[model samples]
Target: MKGVVILGESECSVKDFPDPVPDVGEVRVKMMATGICGSDLHLYHMDKQQAKKRGERIPGHEPCGIVDAVGNGVKKVKEGNRVTIGHWLGCGYCDQCAAGNIMWCEERRGYGGAIDGSHADYVIANERNCVLMPDSMSFIDGAFIACPGGTAYSSMKKLDVRIGDTVAVFGLGPVGLSGVILAKAMGGKVIGVDIIKERTELAKKLGADAVVNAKEDDPVKVIRDFTGGKGTPLAFEASGSAKGRTDIVSSLCRGGKAVFVGAGSSENVINPGQLIGSQLTLMGSFVIPLWMTWEMVDFISTQDITFEGAVTHRFSIDKASEAYRIFDEGKTGKVVFEWS
Candidate 1:
């Protein structure tokens, strides 16, 4: 098997590894497509020690593949099935898992850094974490839907996105773009904000009714202007920057709701006075719940939202280093690594 690894800061290598085998309750998936996410760049920029910890750990989380083998006690899927691997999995018996919130699992294993991830010819995954990919979806789109798509869907549902709602997305990355697509499909007028001109343009193409280039204009002012000065009813922060979170919270209508989906800095600047006086609802969104995962899949499939435009670049696994370089430059849209 050939897998990509992060060696150190600005250093990456694709090397050979032993073929992965399915353990009990697990399955061996023949990698078909893996999406390169913003989180993957965190590993690419790691220092000597973080890189050391990432040694031999294949660095991809959003993977879709064909199940080549299944282990004992597995029942959710079978061999020859196309599936999307969940990056995070908890003990199946945990109350959280039973309740469909795997993010709150007691023994949660986000299977990228500690456990070998999907940037390879093969990967071992817990059967509970594998969602059977619908035949209607392509492997490339299905790969990203596992994470960015699922996260966007979960947040939109939590924000109570609805018809006639002005929804603003504070970042134009993959997650932010996905947010625009879903919000529009659900009948909300979508506004996308991003510092990068290319990203904003891409957002507009995807589904955003309007896009604000934060570098050229004030996003808060532009968003409010578009919404007739009342501001948006729902907003999402996907930039993973404190400033982005500020824009999301500040650009809300009275009694509006905002969900911060990005993992920004430890501390962010938000006005408690505004939060209280405006009766605004602010909350953090995590991974998708099991029930919502199905909803998201169905919604995307039926709505014909492929997010294909967001996937602006593709690379074979051999060029993993180059792939990360372009992604870290932050100039492109979604990037995917294809194994087949």
Candidate 2:
């Protein structure tokens, strides 16, 4: 088997490894496509602490593929089934798992994070973690659904932006772009903000009513002006930048809601008086609940939306290092690995 591994700080290489076999109640999935995410970059840029913990794990969580083999007790899927692996691996009988919130599992584990992921010829997944996909869904599109697409859907649902409402999306990365697509699909007038010209233009092409180059002008002002000098009632912060977060809250109308969908470790400063005076709402959302993600896949299979178009680049597994290099450059949209 061949798999990608982190060599050191900001370094990675694809190396030969022993093939993975499905354990009891597990399935062996041949990787068809694996989407690269921001978390992968964090692993690629392994700091000392993360480096020690990453160990020999393969790096890729957004996996969509065909089942190649099944272990004892596995019955939900068979060898010919096409499937998408959910990011979280949990104990199926736990209360959390029953509630479809595997993210809160005490025995919580995840692929491409603490475990060997699908950035290889094959990966071992528990039957509970796999979602069988319909034939109508493309492998690349299914891959995106496992992460960015699911995250976007979950966050958008939390925002609950109404039809005809003006929504401002801060950041034009893949997730941010996903926000624009979903917001527009729901009939909201969307304004996208990003310092990168490529991303700003891409957002417009996807469905944003307006795109702001935050580097050149104040995003809050631009969004306000676009909405007839009144700020948007809804804002999504997907850039994970402190300035973006602050600007988004300021870019919202009084009594408006802002959803923080990006992952970050830094502390942010917001004035209590400002929040109270405006009666604004700030909600922080994390990953998609496993149960909801399963339903989302079914929802995706039925939608006419072009989620696959979000993929901006595709590379072979052999060019694993190059794939990471391009993604690390942060110049592209959802990047996926294709298997031959």
Highest TM-score: give the candidate number.
1
TM-score of each: 0.96, 0.95
Give the worst 10-residue stretch by lDDT in candidate 2. Answer: 300-309
Q: What is the C-alpha lDDT profile of model 1 across 1-340, one tens digit per residue?
A: 8999888787799999989879899999998988888788788878989788656778888878999998889887799998887777777887888887877888877767668888898989988777776798888767867788888888998888879888999888888988988899889999999999889999988878999888889888998899899988899889888888888787899998998888858775888999999999998888687666666777777877787788888999999889888888888888888876
- In model 1, how large is the Cα lDDT of residue 156? 91
**Residue 29 error for model 2, in Å?**
1.1
Clash statistics: count for each candidate: 0, 0
Model 1 residue 339 lDDT score: 72
lDDT of each: 0.85, 0.85
TM-score, candidate 2, is: 0.95
Candidate 1 lDDT at 46 equals: 85
Which residue pairs does candidate 1 place in steric collision?
none
